[model samples]
Target: MAEEKQKKKGGCLKWGAIIIGVLILFGACAAAMTGGGEDTGDTSSDSNEAETTETATEESTEEETEEATEEVVEEESPDAGIGEQLDVGAMSYTVNEVTTASQVGPSAFPTTANETYVVIDLTVTNNGNEAVTVDSTYFKMIIDGATFDADSAASMSANQNENGEITNSFFLENLNPGSTMSGKIVFDVSQANADNPEKALQVQEGIFGTNSGTINLQ
Candidate 1:
């Protein structure tokens, strides 16, 4: 009987050790599963943040592109016409009339063989509080993309008085506030170009001054 009882106690000890080992293994597996689940959740959060940032960056870039395109369109708008008020800053000008002549020299002056003249009747008004100077050098005639300056001497010699008298040339004059002056500018060009001049003329207020844009001459 004593030997049987001892054997039974040994069996109980062995079974108890086996059950404890199984419980420990199960706990380890559960810990590993929980850690893996936490890692997956962190990765998902990082991915969502990255996606949101990329979307915001794309939207900002699109807005900037649209604004730049609008600016370019405004800059490329077409200019105004002749006999229309063109204000560069403080002064204004208008081309009242345009004429082409076979030749324009002193009443009895000789003419060039292949040269002709284009005259522009201009009116300038000083809109500023102070005086401003208007010079013929600031004017140019564009013919087939070519630019020509006014010929003041030849212009003064043309359209003379009956006694061979000459009119005052329109150049280098000061205009006071609310004052208006009307005069003519003459340009010598080839006969072919004079007959078919460019459709626009350029008027400026100073050397390298602000452009009043191309005025329609047709």
Candidate 2:
């Protein structure tokens, strides 16, 4: 009976050890699974953050591009009209009147136009401190996207007095500061453009001055 009891006790001890080992293995597997899940979650979070940063950067670049385009469009000013003051470089001009004529000058020494004469009566003020030389080339007529130069011959006749006397004051003329001169600038244009309401004058500071302003002829 003693030996049998001892054998039974040994059998219980063996079974208990096997059950403890199985429990320990199960706990280890559970810990490994939990750690793996945490790693996967951290990786997902990092990828989301990277994507969000990239999206924000793209949006900022697009906004900047749109602002730059708008700036370029606002640089152009509107066109000026008759009797309005326009300044280009150092000269300020005002177109008082615009007329059309087939001929000009005295009857004894008159000059005829090829098509029609578009005359612009204007007053120019020497706004600068220094004197500037003025010429007929300082003015041009714009018609139908084309520019026509002043007709110097007809212009010379137009500048004459009633006695058929012409003065060189309007040619290579020197304008003093604070002084103003009024004259008619003539442009020979086609018959169609002479009556067109879309004509304008491109007035400049000098014959070749890059800075210019436009005056609506109508």
Model 1, 1-218: lDDT tens digits are: 99999999999999999999999999999999999999999999999999999999999999999999999976652455767877766767788988877666554673442477777777878888888777778777777788888886656655344467644456577778999877777888777777784556777665676545567777
Clashing pairs in 2: none
Tens-digit lDDT string for candidate 2 (50-145): 999999999999999988888886654346799998887778889999999989888877789989999888888999999988888778888888
Stretches of candidate 2 exceeding 4 Å from the true structure = 1-78, 167-169
RMSD (CA, angstroms), candidate 1: 4.1
Q: What are the candidates' C-alpha RMSDs? A: 4.1, 4.5
- lDDT at residue 180 of model 1 (Cα atoms): 88
Query: Whose lDDT is greatest here?
Result: 2
RMSD of 2: 4.5
Q: List the global CA lDDT of all models.
A: 0.75, 0.85
